[model samples]
Target: LGMRPPTPAHPTPQYKGRARDFLYAGAEAGVMVLNAGADVMRFAPSLVVEEADIHEGMQRFAQAVGKVVA
Candidate 1:
């Protein structure tokens, strides 16, 4: 994946952050996020996925970010 912020792909190495930590936290929160390559987090929801599902997934993602991010 190309440069993506909050996924260890930032232009600044010091602010690149950590994708592993986010992935781990997401897993613990029962949220599944895939890596397109090494940095981009791919969140491909199913066609049957509803609005509420997206909302909930985002909430979980936010929580995971909070866990690993400052």
Candidate 2:
């Protein structure tokens, strides 16, 4: 199946001060160190997903984070 972009992309409003700098710095570090693809932090909604699928996605996300940090 062909890949499709997520609908209704969430917008992260701009921040200011040290927090803004930190966010950018963290993103830069993540990109440099992890070389993660675009979907690394994706949040996909279930079109008709059951509770089990939601749970599985959560578990998978947790596992991915663990692997990245480990």
Candidate 3:
């Protein structure tokens, strides 16, 4: 499990939002995997985010999974 600071230095608003979404998505996927008896979550920092970037990451992660599964 990797924990990153919420905000990145000198990030544009759009990129920051994307990062938050990705982070949220990744976390949700990780939880689902864990519940399904998976061993690990290979989480990494997005290299940027805003102070309000928590739940957005999970949403982004869920979107990614939808695409791949579709």
Which residue pairs show collisions in model 3? Answer: 20-57, 21-56, 23-57, 24-57, 24-58, 25-57, 25-58, 25-61
The candidate that achieves the highest lDDT relative to the unseen native structure: 1
Q: Which model scores highest in TM-score?
A: 1
Predicted candidate 2 versus true structure: per-residue lDDT over 1-70, tens digit per residue? 2443443212233321223233233344342112123222334444565658656655654454444345
lDDT of 2 at 23: 28
In order of appearance, the predictions have TM-scores of 0.70, 0.39, 0.31
Over the stretch 1-70, how does candidate 1's per-residue lDDT look in tens digits?
Answer: 2333332222135424456666677889998876554445667676666769878988998887787766
Collision count of model 1: 0
lDDT (Cα) of model 1 = 0.65
Candidate 3 per-residue lDDT over residues 1-70, each given as its tens digit: 2556433222244343244343344555652211211222334345554535546654665576455435
Query: Where in model 3 is the C-alpha error above 4 Å?
Result: 1-39, 42-51
Clashing pairs in 2: none
